[model samples]
Target: MTLLALKNISLRFGGPPLLDGVNFAIERGERVCLLGRNGEGKSTLMRIVTGQQQADDGDVMRSQGLRIAEMPQDVPKGLSGTVREVIASGGGKVGAALAEYHHLLHENPDDLDRLGSLQQILDTQNGWALDARIDALVAKLDLPADTDFNALSGGLKRRALLGRALALEPELLLLDEPTNHLDLDSIAWIENFLADWDGALLFITHDRSFLRRLATRIAELDRGQLTSWPGDYDNYLRRREERLHAEAQEVALFDKKLAQEEAWIRKGIEARRTRDMGRVKRLYEMREQYAQRRNLQGTAQFTVQDAERSGKLVAEAKNLSYAAGGKTIARNFSTTVLRGDKIGIIGPNGVGKTTLLRLLLGQLHADSGEVRTGSNLEIAWFDQLRSTLDERKTVWENIAGGKEYVELGGARKHVMSYLQEFLFTPDRARSPTHVLSGGERSRLLLAQLFSQPANLLVLDEPTNDLDVETLDLLEELIVDFAGTVLVVSHDRAFLNNVVMRTLAFEGDGRIGEYIGGYDDWLRQRPVATARPAAGTKPKPAAVPVVATAPASKSPLDSKQKRELAELPGKIEKLEAEQEALGLKLATLYASDPGKAVETQKALSAIEQTLATAYARWESLESLRDA
Candidate 1:
């Protein structure tokens, strides 16, 4: 069944339309992701769906009595209640059911009819099993049961809020930038939870891995238009590239045809000048026809100078450390950057990825160790804050230093051509840098960086505000770059595509070097470090196994062997019944109003039976294995 639908939705914010004639729908149990660069109306669309904001002109259709829960981008300030209390405040039938369950458990009711009425509500709401669900959700988000919600860290608070949202068990869940403040462990936990969740999910996030694992479809907002592609992020990107390439070819063919026609008109005009006025008139009409058929020019080209050769050692650091706000961010850190190296710096927020970048660039001095650069190295750095550019200057002046150049056509072109490649038009190129958006500033910086020659590139969060197209261009530039690069980014896709190695910032001022991309680093990270506080000591490295014993005969005794052989069949039969019951419940709820109440009762009974069968099968299987 369709949960929500938007028809011909359009929204404007005092300027151009942010969303124009957008039509989208969310079906029950579908996980759709809203994707776009910042200020592209993703958040606006979420608000419209939740009824917090109304579209300028459109209709929103929602199922009757449908419940939706949203996690806002910013947490409310000065929240007076405890974390647990806040989580329990999700409104709707679940909240009412929980209240009734509490009343039935504690209040001694002299009226038997009222007590029985409360009991029925409790069963209908699944209130008896709510505690187990809450526990599971809290554990999945890695939140401690007794931790004070008011006193928790920012990351922990975010998790606690997400846990509360899940506890509501709403039919639709809306999460915006869910992983923005989470650590890697928390991110992994959320990924696993979303994988198993059986409700409709609509979220906006920058974590590529999370999107790839959870999203069933991708919807991208660009230039006031929404384009949806069915499948994961990888599939969307693949198809987008194919479409772009095809469009480029078509544009090229149009340009070729226009050029051929123009040439023929030029020859005809030259021949008719000496022959007849009628021929000249005809040639003029042909010239006008060819002029109107000219294709729009493509974006300007990006060219970079070959990087100069560097010494064997590109960078070196010895026992480098830094402390801020009574926290040791980097301590006793040492690494060597050799020639032709591409390294990525990754870690949780405030773990010192940016601090390390500053240390390498000599912007900050370490208290103990040394940072040494290779001989004759030229560096071009892209700062996360974009502090390198002068905000008071025009984009053209910033790139060209107030210079003008004459092209082959003898028309004077300002440095706007370079800016246009980064999506800036002629008028926008004349605007002050202070007014540029974050994404525009990022692109302008890259255009300026590539314009100049540098051997060592240091980029901090280069993918922060870039769109998919700009990111692709940057990736291509890095791959073709012959120089060394050290990038710090939280974008997994960008890191995997651009970097060859990783420098991870471990807590307590230590850094670990992982020998691959983000995925490779995840696989090796489990054994890379040990947390004694988590009640597990580091294990010794494993040796290669040369041989293993194999047995064709059953190892168990006769009685156990018979039980083990029968357990598999019993478990399979129970699983099939459980699946059938679940499907029946779904269909009944969708198609038959009369069967809805009956199906709920039947579902509860089937669930109980399935639980018993599963327990018995598990016991037999365990005994056989033992």
Candidate 2:
């Protein structure tokens, strides 16, 4: 069943029409993902669906009594109360009774007279079912029901708002950037929850993994037009490319014919003949068509400015331990980052990912041990909090610093032209930083960071509000960059595609080093029992009990046996390479110092590879004995 439709919709805000003769519809079980660039009219169209805004022209059709709820991009400003009370407010008058009853029963249990009155209201209104549903939702979202909504973190606050949206029991739900600040575990949980949701969903998100897992269809808003593709995200990519290619061809042919007509009409006396009037009229129509055509926006192009090469040992930590606010952040953690190494740091919220980066950069003092940074290491830090940006300053002033020109690739370019390369118009460049959207601010940061030269890039949550196209381009730039990168991100696909290794925080200040990305860590990490909750007593150690091995135990397979036999030889070769590199490093430092960094990088690689081989060999031997 079609829940809602937009027919011949047209909306404009001063300039061009954001939505021109748009037509769209959503069915009962559809999961539609909206893809668009920043500042497009996606949010406006959503408001139109909810009746919060009216289109300047056209009709919005909805089914009789259709229910719609939106989980807004920014949390509502005036929400105040416990989590339960906030969610209950979604149910209207009956929910008000439940909220009051809930408050009285918990906070004023001794006041039975008031509680009795509230209970009677609930009974008469059939509000008990709504109360029960609120209970289930609170537990499912793992929200602190009795806690003040204003006290929760950003991610938790978003979850509470989502609970309220779900409480509405709407036939259609709209979500905007649902995974913005969530950790990996929370994102996974929400993905699972929404996959099982029965209602139709229309959401805007830049998370490719989430879109791939949820979207049954893809919809794009481009240059005042809405287009829908009937398949997954990958399918849309393939088909959109074909569509654009064909469009280019058609436009080229039309322009050629128009040019030929212009030449014929330019023949003054010959074209003034009566028979030529029809051809002249057709030329005028072609000009109108050409004037109305809307072109596609160009992709953002940027490159990092390179500085002088740094020493081979970018940074090293030994027995490093740090603590803040009486909580352990890192305990006896150690790692070596050589030049050209790209490392990704990931953990739950407030789990010290940024702290680790600071510790490595010598920006903060460690509680114990030490960090050693190499020589000539120029660092450019992309702060997640956007503290580097001055909200009071205009975009051009923030980036240009009173200069009319900036240097790019050894050439001086005007500030306006530089900003334009990032898709920022002159008017937008003059706008204050506070007025820019999340995506625009990110772009501004990139423009600022790339204008200067550096050898070490430290990015903290840099992927938060960027569009998918920019994210892909950023990933490519990082992969091709000559400098070392230490990025802290929650984007799984970005991590998988960009980083060489990962540093994951396992609980209790323990940081584990894995050879690859998020999925690689999952495969190699050992299965362990859940830890006890805070303030819980430790369980007594269990007495060991011996058991006999099963008689039907299978021997190692042929492939496993072959891998086991080859491990020793690989380990030996790596050790020999490690020794040679070490000796060469010493000789180069004394004789040809410029070549020492390359030798040192090779030595570090061999050491890590050798460690992996040793671990594999031990595992194989244990399996053989079993």
Best TM-score among the predictions, by candidate number: 2
Candidate 1 structure quality by residue, lDDT tens digits, 27-130:
77778899886567898999999999999998998999888998776676755344544555553465555544444455655667766776777677676576
* Backbone clashes in model 2, listed as residue pairs: none
How far does residue 384 in candidate 2 sit from its true spot (Å)? 1.8
Tell me the whole-model lDDT of each prediction, alpha carbons only: 0.73, 0.86
| Candidate 1: regions farther than 4 A off | 11-20, 36-41, 72-169, 180-183, 222-227, 241-309, 321-324, 387-413, 430-438, 448-451, 526-626
TM-score of each candidate structure, all chains considered together: 0.64, 0.82
